[model samples]
Target: MKTRIFQLLPISAAVACLGFAGQANADQTVRIGHVAPLTGGIAHLGKDNENGARLAVEEINKKGLTINGQKVTLVLDAQDDAADPRQATQVAQKLVDDKVVAVVGHLNSGTTIPASKIYSDAGILQISPSATNPAYTEQGFKTAYRVVATDAQQGPALALYAANTVKAKSVAIVDDATAYGKGLADEFEKKAKSLGLKVLSHDATNDKAVDFRAILTKIKNERPDVIMYGGMDATGGPFAKQARQLALRAKILSGDGVCTEKLSDLAGDATDNVVCSQAGQALEKMPGGADFQKRYTARFNQPIQIYSPFTYDAVYIIVDAMKRANSTDPKKVVAAMPATDYKGVIGETTFDSKGDLKKPVISLYNYKSGKKALLDVVTM
Candidate 1:
């Protein structure tokens, strides 16, 4: 009788283990997708943003969250949009088809703006860390939002600086023809003209173009006191280099798009004295920048870039929203977003009625020793 009981106990334990395994296989997990230009001209910046999102998931899941009375695991699904709007559509569709609970990004404003429509229709929440185009949220898409202030705000801030600080009387505008590029160029043009500055010339360039001898030559003749580039580093770098080669010699200014190490690589010595506006001041200057920077460097084995702090904050914002809504339902998560003052790595972040960041600060930087460092902090 004893021997028979022992053999039965072993079989019972095996059955219990199999049942647990089956339940685990059927367990529901919360998944989020991140879309970026992982393989193209902006791949490095994309990778930085993607890593930030992934780090957020890793830290959140390690805490072992429970939603709806069940254990929840946060999973990250990465997709490459190649910084193209058409490809952004493909990547966004893939995320929706995969049924992720939310999405963290489509980095560029051009890609983010179009892909947002798809996410809006599908009822998926998207929070962009770096897409600053005004039209991104102006379309009245309830599910689309960004953590950084728009180019509409930062563009004019730079224009004011050009007129008031630099005392410039003439300015030239250039754009790469993307949504982010054109919108900012327009804003600067409007404000620069209002400030009684002469508009030297406006020209368009393709993102793939590496040569800008023609554009620089035209600007040289016009002789603007300053040149404002509304484009990313890929073209901005070469334009800076070519401008120097052509002896245009105008002071160059760019937006957050050109705030990267790649600008130095592109322009080499020509990157000197160039200025741009990015989201926040150096980590050492912010209230908690020091601690966050330490952790980021320890984890990633490198210094943080422009959008990583925003992306890091984006993760916590979503997590906090999920907790507040008491659910991971996309609609509920979004509804809770604007009401919360999310204290993220960048500082206390709050959204306005338009789902845009309200009066967030912008920091100015110039190239020093081939790196971008804080010059001044501007409130916008």
Candidate 2:
């Protein structure tokens, strides 16, 4: 009986050793959610944001990081919101339910605002790469953070630039009627009027609308020196293209939403007439801009869009918080995030009390021969 018992114990010990070895070799996946408009008019920009996050995840996994004394692998839970607020909320909840440690998107302000509540309720960290509405961070949600300046800053800067540099006497405004569009347009109008420039007209259009002939014709009658648009490049580009087709000579001005490489292709021959603003420093000015562009292009086989660098930085910021907390738990990461001060591809990043970036910088840009040219940087 003793010999039989010894034989059984050896078999059990062999099985246990195999199990332990397998567990040691396996990596625990830590999911990080990424929400964006991956299947709509602005899908190109949305995909660009996702690609940035994915690149970071892939690189981090390659390094074989161990957090909490366990080999951990980062995973991306990418959800498509189609740039719709309702869809954004749905996906936000889904990501929360999926137990993502942090969220890095919902690119449009309209979507980001609604989705932020879901993340806050779940106590997950959310760092938007492109949503610039002031209301997003002003709501006192501890979980909310953004890498870009708010519309409160971007709108006035563009308006001031138009007043001082463009020397515009009158400006016509058009918005896509989304939260981001109307909000930015309203801010621009306030500053433009304060600067003593006449606002000839302010028109609203749906984002899905492609024809701007009616509005352009009416705007031409006003004969403004500048036409400012508050919307994404998906709509803003066509708006400029149509404005040029109607033979309007007014220069086109817009906020960060319309500032992207895709704008030139979307606007085609009319690209040179458009000048836009971005919420951060120009790429040339960012510490990691050149290396980031090289790596991003190599990974995605595409040029970096306006918000890619921001999203990339956002991913790294979340990881920074996770490492600081020494855990992949969402609550721990959120708690560590308020103190984040990471130097990233965009520049130095530090969030204020309201989750808004401190010392925000804005860059003015124009397109020439299908290339985006930097004009100036305004720091605040």
Candidate 3:
């Protein structure tokens, strides 16, 4: 009996030791929020952004992330705002309730601007991958940050290209009436006038408008050398298609919203007549773009849209801040964000006082044979 008791004691000790080892290496789950219009007309773009974040989260876990000496498992709590301002606010509140340490998303300027206040009030960090409205950062919300350049820069870059490269003497402007569309069109108009381009006419169309013949017919009669559209491809593509159907031969100039890999499908052969500017460096020119593209395609079996690289970098940026702060606490992570100098798939990213990128690059593109081709890259 004594020998049997001794043997059982040793087994019990070994079991206790194994339990302690397991506890020591236990993973602490951390929640990160991603909000985008996942169910709307631009769902593809939102899914692209979510895929980037998910890939980062997966990679981080696979590579072993230790935050403040504890192994951490990142969980992405992705939400859909449906590209509506009211829905955006609701989604923001939901993420806040979910207690995410940081957020990456709200892709549209209209949605992002409304959602930022919720994140700011909750003291959470909100990093936008593609919101280009200057007002997004101008709102004075310390919590708001965007990886891409603002309409203030993108609009002028497109205008300069139209006035100099396209050599357009007169231009007509059109907007989808959303914050991003109108704001970009406004900025483009300001730069176009300063560059001595005649203003033919400016028109407003709702984002959901399908038939643009009335507006396109009016602009066709104006006979402008160029037509600048400030909206997403959903509307802009059809707008361009209708313009061509009306025999309007003017080159269509647009901002990033209308520039997409899917635009050719929407605009058909009229895509050849469209020239657009993206608010960042082209993917092929990004520092880690090629490698990222290969990995992303392998994981998702799909092509990237405009903002996936930015979203991918945004996730890394959030994790970087967590490492710097040594805590997954939202406030602590946010406090560490201002000093960030991390280089990722989108190249180097540094923020200014307004949470805007200190240096931004804009890329111009045009479609040929239903494919987007990079024309030039502008640094600002």
As a whole number from 0 to 100, the lDDT of residue 2 in candidate 3 is: 97
Model 2 TM-score relative to the real fold = 0.94
For each candidate in the order shown, give its overall lDDT on alpha carbons. Answer: 0.85, 0.91, 0.93
Itemize residue pairs with steric clashes in candidate 3. Answer: none
Measured with C-alpha atoms, the lDDT of residue 360 in candidate 2 is 96
Worst 10 residues of 2 by lDDT: 61-70
Clashing residue pairs for model 2: none
Per lDDT, what order, best first?
A: 3, 2, 1
lDDT of 3 by residue, 107-176 (tens): 9999999999999999999999999999999989889999999999999998999889889999999999
| Residue 50 displacement (Å), model 2 | 0.7
Report the candidate with higher lDDT, 1 versus 3.
3
- List all candidate RMSDs to the true structure: 4.0, 2.4, 3.3
User: Ten residues in a row with the worst lDDT in model 3?
Assistant: 36-45
- What global local distance difference test value does model 2 have? 0.91
Please give, for residues 1-380, the per-residue lDDT of candidate 1 as tens digits: 99999899989999999998778655458888898899878788898898888888888888778766667888899999999999999999999999887898989999999999999999888999999888988898888878887887778878888988888999989999999888888888988888899988889987778888888888898888899999888888888888888877778988988888678887998889688888554555667677777777788997676687778778788888888888888888878877878877777888787788875778888898888877888888
Score residue 129 of candidate 2 by CA lDDT: 94
